[model samples]
Target: MRIDVHAHLWTDGYLDLLDSYGRTDTATQRGTGAGATAQELEARFELNDSAAITHQILSISPQVPHFEERAHAVHAAAYANDLYAGVVADHPDRFSAFAALPLPHVDAALTELARALDDLDMAGAAVTTDVLGASLADPAFTSLFEELDRRHAVLYVHPSGHDAGTPLIADHHMRWMVGAPMEDTIAVMHLILAGIPSRYPNVRIINSHLGGALPMLLRRADDQYQWESPQTPDKPSAAARRMWYDTVSHGHLPAIRAAAETYGPDRLLLGTDFPYQNGDLLRRAVTSIHDALPGQDATTVLDRNATALLNKA
Candidate 1:
């Protein structure tokens, strides 16, 4: 019943495609999103061992080349889909896949979504917190959301270093530690506040890195905007707390506890950030969190809830 909802794997063809796009920056080449082969990932996850994970959902790391030109972005997106498909095909038992897509281009993304799901048999698609210069709530993404809703597809969102050309995120250390979380928080805010959750309630969106410090900052965000009149008629409370998050907060116990406390165990999924991080570390972190919680609640967070999310329990 062990199902890790967040993990990444890439293929050589995919790396070649990303390299051809001519838009890779420091962020794409460094950090967690840096591309690695399936064999390397298997070794990292110790998949050859008897203690290897039972199931992993592979996703293309969001740090794929980001291009302002629509045509190049479309090509990169297709390449990503192909790479993810190949990875999952190679290890159908040990892995399942979520497709990568070009966002902010509804037509291209929707077209690829059909191919990825119908042709590749992928579970869903993975998107970044933001698409180029636009947020998740941008009008351009409405059709994309509607299409995913129709398919009842899962949308996995990972943080990216995008910030409207801001120079502050150029510092790699600063960007990943601070900028990435900020990007996640802002992107989730746009989706919730802009009414995407209510409009497309069936679409399941999973945010990585424990919603990127969202559980801790949500109260401040809620309190500050409680009095301000929303542009939309729907109250933000329901949509804000209703989203899902993964437990990949670098094994920080307090952060793990805070996320569970803020969002509750029902919406939390087990995530190891595998290949980039040690799964054993994640297990230890979850164990620590379980030690602090009352009764079987700890066991639920460690595995049961994730099982329910993936329907493998």
Candidate 2:
């Protein structure tokens, strides 16, 4: 299928829903060069065709509508899912999506997850690394994961833009530069240490940006996780292999190669953090994989892996 497992779209209606519901954080993305106009949309699609990216699995992250207000969170999530469902319906050949859930509000998230998956027929759910400040591994999120596990759904973990609650990264202006993947590293660490993968084996968890330095840190974690995180139910490496990662390290071949070496080739999927990685960078996201690995393995990563993963639904 040549599916790109990571792409993001922020429609005007989705942004308006967030703003009307009092979400001020999303305003900056309104016209950050990735416009909602038809011309820009066609340009994006044409670029996808150039890259041989037949399909794109879109998501909204770093600016998800996860306000603490129950009404606000639920409404925003429902609107986002409906909007995504419409796009997929209108362009099924080019788009599929992970549902944005109202997290830090599990029951509501559960409800919206049901609607998005069962009714809207979206691919699966996407959540930020943390809900407000709580970790995904926290027991508070277990029920949500339980339901996800039951359905054998895909859980896309994206950075929440808050920089993993770290003062150093949050205080500095490097939030998205390195902080984005830092959130990715810490969030996945929380899951590994808390046994998220082991506990909910069926939930196909996909981490962003090559699992946020995970290619480098997996062995270090495997070495020290025993005492550092004694309560972990399984080996860090074992749990990590159960999860998946996307090649979104700004098309860095070494990072991609390291990930392929650390985790098996099957664990990697093609991704371009679109708009953010648009134009030539988007094209490079695909071509770089072929450059970094053998022909057969690159083919599996670019095409076969995502087809197998998405079809698991």
Candidate 3:
């Protein structure tokens, strides 16, 4: 079976849920529409006639940073969890959900994290690369990471293009084109160099967009930090090299092949940034990976590997 581990869905009544948070810009306004719920996503699937896509995991867009204040952030996370729970409940067979957490608010995020996992029965939680410019490896957020590691939480790393110097919006077309991947690369780098893998070994991070320029810079990141100077500890940076990436490169055959060659098959997962890009494009991208690899390697890349990562097995 085909399992698309990376997909998003937003409910029509999401506005009502967000009404209390005050009027704020959403992912929809940004043209990515990463905030759409499962109901909206289902409709899109039908409209696109993508009936072949059977099992999918639904998550929210991490691009929209809502936790400016601690109170607002907690409320926003609670509401998102409630809404996503309802989405999974309504369509248990068709979709599973990842809980959205408010970062930088460790205590509040910890409480909501437990609630989402224990009470809401979510697969895991989605996290931005950083919280208000602070990297995920910051001490303020270490408890949440520790808890997630203990609970065996899958931390989906969705970069928010939040860097101030090169604001994604400043570049106009470069926002998602260049900015998204750059932000993701920075986030992953921080997680790796800060020794997150060593600290939280159980935390499974899903790096979106084929690990966001990581494949291209694998040699640079690994090579430069091999000895680990003042920037990194005295250790090889193989942990960063060993990460889970998705196949949402938009039908780029060479990129997909190169990623598999660099990261290997087991590290690759099935991802289709559906409801943002065309579903057909996702299908083609996945198929390209399968075609590139031979025998069980292709099978593992297409579905087996994703199932193991998402714990759908």
Candidate 4:
């Protein structure tokens, strides 16, 4: 029973909202079409079937509403969460969902978070690496993190390609390919440096794209920690191990192996990034991980870990 921990779907209403704001990108547009009809969803399922995927945890891509306008952000978040609830209701066996929240607006976000979890029965919440221009470790989100930790909720950290720095290589859409991971790396570093993991130890954060550059940079972070603050109780690598990572390296075996080695198979979760990268690549990712690990470890990566996370949530 393969369970895909990372997949995305956007309701037509949400897509229309994006279009109205001129925020429709290739991924968002594809998501709009994918959620248009039952046939479209079935096509997605057919691809999952080929990959031996029995279930998926659906989430919205990082096209979260800008927090400048509180009303728009709040409405969009509620709408998206409600729409996702309907989708999950229609296909309870095939899919589950992580709700989207309006960040940078603590009160509104808290309200929606409660509604999505308590009322809508969502699996968890999907948040961007940064809220507006603020880091996830920002003090403004203290209550938010505290609440999530108290509830033992799964926090899916998706990337927005925001603040990836000046692009040196623009050819072949390098910004997205390179920038997205960089954003995730920065976000993780901020969380670690700010002591978020230690403060909110119970909040389960699943970093996307195999935790971006974290697997490779963890040793460097630890070295810096030792040199700068040896008295610190939590080392960088130790703090990183507390979080989870998804297997969505876009078919990269080395990334998967590195994450598994660093975080262990128990911390690894199977992810497809479906409707954005497609199911064929997801199948390839699954195959690659299976090839890299022992049978039981691969099984744990593919399903057991996600099941455990879901059950805990």
Candidate 5:
């Protein structure tokens, strides 16, 4: 089956939930294109048929429910996860979801992870780059990672709207165009430097945006990691290959080809970043991959990789 590992579907209730949390941008964002209403889902299914996608794993990200207040975070996380659980139940064939965690609060997050997986039967968990300004590689998140390792679970890391704490980008209005990928690079590197993948080998970590400069940085790190971070357990390139990446480069064949070359074809999976790339653009996201690589390699990425990963998880 050709499954898209990176897509988002925000229900009106989910949007309303975020609004209650004081998320000011909900009005502009979260258009009907990303909603789960019958009409919107029909539009999404049409795009999927045109793109030849069999299934799409949905997630709530970039606008994740993690908050500063512990109680609020817990309520938000549970609300989002339960809502997505229902979303999956309602569309068993077309949709599955990654549960949202009340992160930066590891204990709460751990509890929610167990509930989401064991009770809600969520496919996995989704989180932003930084856990409300703390690095995921920070020792505080170690227990959560350990539990994920124990479960052999998947963890999808998307950019937090804050852009990984780079004020220059946030203040200068480079939020998505430049800041989003920068956040991806920073978050993944934090894990790489801390030996997250090497240590928690069972956890299948998926980085967004073709790993956000990882393909280009691996060689640089391989060359310098010995002196720069001798404590790192393995070569950055080697440790990086131990993880997975989604092909969501907005139909940019060169970027997709670069990521495939860096991570190998088997590690690449199809990801349309739905609603963001709807209509004709969504169709092109899949076709561009076939154009970027040889037929067999593209087929493996498009059809085989996601099924293998999800099946294992």
Candidate 6:
């Protein structure tokens, strides 16, 4: 059985919140499979039956509104969390959910996280790479990280809107294809450089899209660290092993192999990026991993790692 660690759902209330804030990007405009019906989910499951995906953990996509006004962001987060709670309640066997926190609004996010995990019983929290242009490693987020550490919360890091001046691959309409993963790479690098994994040892972080470009660039990062800041407490690659990564490389074999090589089968978990990827692509991605890895290693990625992560939470 496969336990897909990454999937997304959008509720009308959540979309309305984004619209109210004028946060309509291409993902939002297209709705990006957020409002899929129960029947649609079942159909998707049937389509992925070949992959044996028995469970999916749903998170709000990165299209979240990082409101400049803290109150609005908090309210939006609460609404999204409530929506996720309802989905989990209705499909307890087939689905679990992660909470959306109004990040950067550190105190409010902490409160909502407590409510989501303790009260709503969410699987964990899903956060974007940055919170209103602030990196996750910013000093302002230390309290929030501490709270997550205290609870031993499972934190899923996804890419958010990019603030780069010019879009990469804009002509190809693959901003998401290129930019999102780049953001994930940057975010993970920032967290590692700032020693987040070592500092928050108890917090279990699962970075999406095979940890973006991290697997490929980690050696370079380590070399740079050795040359630039030899005084740092830990090596970038060593700190990375303490974290987990999901197999959402969109069926890119080289990327999957790189992640598997760097993180190993134990640290790798299966992910679908559902709705965005749809069932066929999801199945293909899983198949690709199976093809690339040896016997039990593929099975470990498909089921064991995700089961372990969920059980840990």
Against the true structure, candidate 3 reaches a TM-score of: 0.87
**Ranking of models by TM-score:** 5, 2, 6, 4, 3, 1
lDDT of 6 by residue, 94-166 (tens): 7888899886788888899999999999998999888878888999999988999999989999888563223
- Estimated TM-score for each candidate: 0.86, 0.96, 0.87, 0.93, 0.97, 0.93
Identify the candidate with maximal lDDT.
5
TM-score-better candidate, 2 vs 6: 2
What does candidate 5's lDDT look like per residue over 241-274, in tens digits? 9999999899888899899999999999899888
Worst lDDT window (10 residues) for model 2? 27-36
The weakest ten consecutive residues by lDDT in model 5 span: 23-32
**Rank by lDDT, descending?**
5, 2, 6, 4, 3, 1
Expressed as tens digits, the lDDT of each residue in 137-194 for candidate 3 is 7878888878988988888877665542374455565666677777777787777787
How well does candidate 2 match the true structure in TM-score terms?
A: 0.96
State the lDDT of candidate 2 residue by residue for 89-149, as single tens digits.
Answer: 8789988999999878899899899989999998889998888888898899889999999
Residue 20, candidate 1: alpha-carbon lDDT = 70
Better of 1 and 5 by lDDT: 5
lDDT of 2 at 94: 86
Quote the positional error of residue 141 for candidate 5 in Å.
0.5
